[model samples]
Target: METLRQYRENLQKIYGKNDYWMVPIFRSLFSMTFLFFLSRYLQMTGKLGNPMVILSLGLLSFFLPFSFVPCLSGIFLLYYFYTQSILLLGVGALFFVFIFIIQSSVRGKYAILIAAMPLCFFFRIPYFLPLLMGLTMGLSAVISLDLGILVYYFLRYIREYKDKFSTGGDLVEQLDAFSGNLAPFIKNKELFLVLLLFTLAALAIFVIRNFSFNYSFETALAIGLCLESTAFILYPAVGMKMNLTGELLSFLLSAVLSIVALFFWHDADYRGTEFVQFEDDAYYYHVKAVPKKKA
Candidate 1:
């Protein structure tokens, strides 16, 4: 525990010193990574998908606010959809407009979860979403995460159906068939399972972490991972096939990583905790303060 606390202090010192350049460098890498995955997922090896082009665009992203990365991703997505069909591109446009409306309204913290969702899904390490978002960003992060998951599955199902639907049929008929098929996809057990598990687990962790108690964050992470693991373990009973052993192993790995993240992001000294009471002209206040550990 002391080692972890010391490491976090050293990390903060380094970040404080280099943040001016480090943030942009990290942002560039994140943008490039997102585009790289976008290329592979969309199977675009053209100019837009070129590594040099991706690197250039990523460098440009360093000058833009981090929020711009999502717009950048959407533009890339829309272009990919354009390569597929004019109609498809229109659908993607409307989808982005809808997402923009919601994202603008809430304007939650850790907006990058919108991108992280698809990225983690692609990497098959989605088990960390609940604990990561809940512990770090609280319940509001779940909204962004939900959007990301929807984008991932939406793109996934659309790609699977694109070839089947784009057989040069009547335009209206194709649209009708596309919208019609979405029902079953919407009802997909896998989609619902992801939504349910992530929502509940994140919410649970958010609530637990807010409690004023010793080891609240650690307890929250443990319980959240247990809940998530249990849900995945019972997927077979729900008639959804999954590799039980593989899922368990993934959960275990995610749990270890979540612990590491929690230690760095949230650690306190209960021994240094203080309770105080003060009376002002208006009212009296009772306070409990737990100081975060530092080197």
Candidate 2:
């Protein structure tokens, strides 16, 4: 009884903290405004046809609440091919336009990639391109918000550590000293690992197919999940200064894992069984063993 009371008290303390949720709301608002301005520039200057415009458009629409519109619409179209395919497709296209509208509110280039997952899933689009889109967008927004929080904490740390600095030149000199110490840890190990995993995923997609390893919607979805989760878990770590570079590193690992998951799903034969189904107004799925793996 005493232990239970203590646990409940701990839970109350943790739940009482409300500031964590504020950054995401702020990020969404900021990113939305950034996208509006960017789109206006592109459309007015008539540079929307350029490849850079594609990236810019992606940045604009990545963080909005309505960003998932095209994704849901596309999924509906696929599911209701007999009735609403055309209408759903048009809606999906419009949603894509919105995604292009709010891209820049985030800070990192990679965050844009994270916002494109739902679109790929909705439209049955294949390949790592959409994964790239969602990750870039999500990462960008996450990094911006995180950096602001980090700066606040860093300022506090400086105040407490003021005695450690000997002279007026301490700010730059101390920061440089700190950077020099941290340089070894940021030597691209995480980046290389992530790229290697992605490369393996690409190879698997090509090698796993009978005649050719082809990219599929499953592949994109798998990778997107991995990447998003990576961003999710790593963001707080970065903000807390627990592992400054861990977010990027973990994201890379997550990306690779996602690719591998996609391959597994691809290789598995569904045997005409539906992976997801709605029954009595509730959605569910039937999990089946791999036929070849059955004893």
Candidate 3:
């Protein structure tokens, strides 16, 4: 435990010392990954799919505000969609505008977390996201989580309909394609489950960990995993086909990853001997005492 704490402290110190350069490099890598995956998945590598251009954009992301990544990504997506379907591009544009509005409201504190939701979905470790957020965040993060889910589903809609959309077709055909892609939220059982499992579970875990009790974080984390496991049984009800063995293996992996994350991010937050209490409109807050970081 002593060795682990020292390691955590050293990692924190390293980050603090290097974050000036480190932040951009990490963001740049993420930008490149995002663009590459989008292009690869679409199987449409035009100028936007050029490796050199992607690298240049990554470098630019390092220099400019990270917001530039999403803007470029959005414009690129809209233009791509425009080639496929103008009405579809219009829908993407609206989503883009709404995201910017929400981004401004949240001050982008959880932007990385939110942006990572789809990536998590792609990597099949989406179960890790809510628990990590619940461990470190407050209710304000709900917006970020919701936005992330929105982006995930929006991209899914694009993928599902891309083959069906008309680049130049009769108005009736375009409308038909657009309307089908705009499937009702209630019809998407997975969406409902995600809200219940990830969003609500995270909020519940947040509340549980903040309670005045022993081992609250552990309890909360355990319960979060339990909730996740319960979701497997719900797959059939949600109209989702399941591969039981594969899912079981994924659960084990997600559980291990979640625990590791808890260690690296949460447990490292060692506390001093003081307890503090504060409150907001919705709930009271109990802050664990800790030595302040060095100046």
TM-score of each: 0.91, 0.23, 0.84
* Candidate 2, 222-250: lDDT as tens digits: 54445444534544544533343654554
**Runs of candidate 1 exceeding 4 Å displacement:** 165-170
Overall lDDT per candidate, in order of appearance: 0.82, 0.38, 0.76
**Cand. 2 TM to true fold:** 0.23
Worst 10 residues of 2 by lDDT: 118-127
Model 3, 166-208: lDDT tens digits are 6668767888866765765327777768767888778878889
Candidate 1: give the clashing pairs. none
Residues forming the 10-long window of minimal summed lDDT in candidate 1:
158-167
Error of 1 at 5 (Å): 2.8
What is the TM-score (0 to 1) of candidate 1?
Answer: 0.91
Best by lDDT: 1
Better of 1 and 3 by lDDT: 1
Residue 254 of model 3: what lDDT? 75
Model 3 ranges off by over 4 Å = 1-3, 184-186, 268-295
**Full ranking by TM-score:** 1, 3, 2
